[model samples]
Structures are given as C-alpha cells and as structure tokens.
Target: MKTVKQGDSGEEIAILNNALTQAGYSVKEGMTFTPALRETVVAFQQQRGLEPDGIVGYHTWEALLLGGESEATELADEDFSRGALLLDCETAALRAVQEVESGSRHGFVAPGKPTILFEGHIFWAQLKKRGIDPVQYAAQNGDILYPQWEKGHYRGGLKEYDRLEKARAIDREAADASASWGMFQVMGFNFAACGEKSVASFVAAMQQSARSQLKLFVRFIHQGGMLFALQRKEWATFARLYNGPRYAENRYDVKLAKAYAKYAR
Candidate 1:
C-alpha cells in the first residue's frame, strides 16, 4: 500500500528498481529512484494503462506486485526456505508444482514481458456466458485456447500479449478473463478462485513477485478442494484438476511426481 516516486531514496527504491529490472527494463535497483528509474516507471505505467506520471503509487504498487518480477532471489524450489512456507502443505509438494508450472529458476520472467497463455475455449465459454456471440470471433482467430501445446511446448509470451490486445478490443472484461497468466498460468476468469475480486486485479497480481503468485495458487487449491492432493502427493488428481482432463496427454502427473521426488530428497 506504500507509494514511491522520483527522488525517493531508501530500501523501497532498491526494491522497486529490482522489480523494474526483472520486468525487463534496463533500470538498476538502487536506493534512489533516479532518472533511470523514473523512465522505467513511466514506460511501465503507459504499458499497463496507467498515467505516465513516473510515479509509483498504490495502484502501481499492486500492478508491480502482480507483475512478472520479484524481489526474492530465484533459486531452486527444492530449497525448503525459498517461499514454500507460504503453502499450508509440505514445502516440497508446492515446490514440485512450482518446478513444473513455471520452471522460472533464474528470474520471475524472461526480463521483459510477462509470459502468458490465452485459452480460447475458456474465452469462448466466458463470452458465451456474458451474452457475447463467439462465432465471429472464432472465424477471426482459430483455436484461441492454443490446443496444440504439448510437453514442454507452449504458445505464450508476446504472442499472448497480441491475443489479449485483440480480445480487449472486442470485449475488455472477457478478454482479460480469457488469458492464463504468469509463471503459474492462472486464467483471468479464475480471479476469484485465486482470491481476487476482479480480472484486472488478478492480472495486476500476476505482475507481482513469485511469492504473490504462490499465494494465489494456494488460494486456488483451497477453493477447488485440491489441497488434499498436494498434501497426499496425489499427482494424478492434482494434475487433472489443475491442467484439465487431458492432463495425461502432457504427462503433467508424471512430471509432478518426478519433481516432487526430486524435492522430497
């Protein structure tokens, strides 16, 4: 809830600087919100639909927290001390999930835009429920769900940014809800499931640190009644519920098992 702006100097400045760097800006994390930091803030504000005032306020703070950067050192999830304590279940279990879901070891994101995967089917359903016809949309964009993803492959990153832009043009609310975001790939429609009130708020949370993502993941698990899966190491149940019925096609269950085993040590 704290606000930071230009000429600000202290630990918060360094933290903001680090988040900016992780978000792919060439700003240095320092004690002062120097000219370089101001530039980065302005660019981010413009990209995120905020006024380009170069001021880091409450709203921007929320966006940054939910964005693709982190103040935590990205380390092996197997390291028990690394943020896994936030999970009510065994740290290893959550770590295993993190390993498979994101694989973001060195940084929260690739030092640029947050990686995202848009689910066309989910979008289609959301639009239908919202009383918006989807046929015309399908004619324009085939398979928005990106049905072909398999194994380590995916359709995301800037490709998804473009997809979302188009979706926003048609229907902003539905478009935001359609895309799965962050290292966790949480769908925007599942915002409430992730403990957020609105899709926009959820997207902002995704822009924050990994710890925030994990918090949402935990909330999601609890809401979906899948906490037991993590507790018992029920990878099949967890994978199917988390990744959908076709979880076996991607062997997500098996990957979870392997990852859990590695972290269980």
Candidate 2:
C-alpha cells in the first residue's frame, strides 16, 4: 500500500480511501491522505484487533482485499466464462496462455494493473500519424520505442512503462494501442476493437482485475475476427492476426500449439 499515512497523495491513497468507504468508513473525495483517513484506518485496525498504527501495512491490505469474500475467486469465474464464450475453449487453454504470457494473472506492473509488452510497430504508426520523425525519435530514445527491438534492449515481454509514457507524451490514443494489456497482452490501440470507448476506459478496465483483462482479450479476439481461428485451434491464423504479420517468424503459432497441447492433454 506504499506506506500510506497523512500527507501522502496519489492514486494509492485514493484507492485506500475508497476501500475504507466500502468497508463502512467515511472518506473524503480525493487522493490526499488526510487526518480523517488516519482516524478511519485506526478505527478499522482496532476493530480487527490490530495495532492502531493508522497506517496501511500488510495486515491492512489483507483485510481490504479479503474482507467481504474473495475477489480472486469471483474474478476467476468471470475469466473462465468470458474465455469460453469468446474463444470457445475451456479453462485449460486459457491457463496455458496465461502461463506462457505473464507467468500468472496477477503479474502486475502497477497495483491492480497487468504487465504489458510495448509494440514498436504501433509506436512507428503513431509517430508517423503525428508527422513526427520516427528515425529521429529512435536516434534520441535509442530504439527503446521504435521498430528495432534491439535498440531498446527489449528481450521479450519486458515491462515498457518508460516506452508507454513516452508514447503517451506523443498521443494518448497511440499510447493505449502501443502496449499489449492484461494476461492476454491484447494491444491497447485495440480498445475500440475490444469494445471500449477510449484508452482511459481501456486502461481502467485493465486495472480492474484479471477477469476484466480476460473480457477485454475476448473482445479483442472477437473484434479482430480471430475468434474462429481459436475455436478451430488454428493457432497459425490466430497468432498471425493477433500477434501481427510476423507471427510465423516469432513462432507464436508453434508456441500456442504447444501450450494448447499441454492444456488439452
């Protein structure tokens, strides 16, 4: 919880306040960790027989996450339903994909946000659209945000927060599309394809939980016209459309084939 206390600020503080409110405590509308927030924390801690330190530590996090039934269990059910509906596959396929992609559904980049792999192709497109010289950008950023992966020192599935932030500086829409989001790593630019209104909404949905991540992924597959490929176990077609035209060289289809075989067994 980032060691929340009075005078602290930002989204984490705001989230803590919201959790307190959901647990039947009052909180002001904002991100600031005020004196009242401390009081509320102490009260909650006291009720749970914890030291009234007025700080959100590990114990507080446990209480907040598991207080009223487990969100994890609920999210898992949603993920399975959504995956089955969209991909026409069972949980095994989905689990295998998750295992290959992010190691786990909870492999978060930030609190409540899934890790992402930034796309150089999307960055080039965004830069060209803005009339910005991508070559010049690559020259300055050292390929960390461009077509050449090595220039960025990226070694597959690395967290690209700096790259994403740079893209956001250029354009939010492009930034959203430039990074693959969630357990499925669906590109953010696919927000509309995923049935989202904007990048912000897509990011918020991505931050909601793994269930929402899976839902977003299903929508992406459906909108991209790749659902049939997955349904028929045509990993070549699915990987090509979903991963890009270079999926063959990347062996994404082969990987998906092996993952599915492991799960289908």
Candidate 1, residues 1-265, lDDT tens digits: the string is 2477888898778767766776677876569878878888999999889888988874465456444444553444433332342233677787787778767643244543455776667777778878988886777666453234432323455666776777777788888897776666677888998879998888777666555666566568767777778778999999988888898987999999999889789
Off by over 4 Å in 2: 1-78, 148-152, 155-159
Candidate 1 matches the true fold with a TM-score of 0.64
lDDT tens digits by residue: candidate 2, 1-265: 3467888888878778777887898878888988888998999999988789998865575465334433341245444543563354666666656766666667465676468877776777777776777777666665346664432445344357766776677666766777777777877777888778987899888877666676677667656887678777788887788877887777888888888888778
Off by over 4 Å in 1: 1-83, 105-112, 143-154
TM-score for each of the candidates: 0.64, 0.64
Clashes of each: 11, 2
Predicted structure 1: lDDT:
0.69
Backbone clash total for model 2 is 2
Whole-model Cα lDDT of every candidate shown, in order? 0.69, 0.70
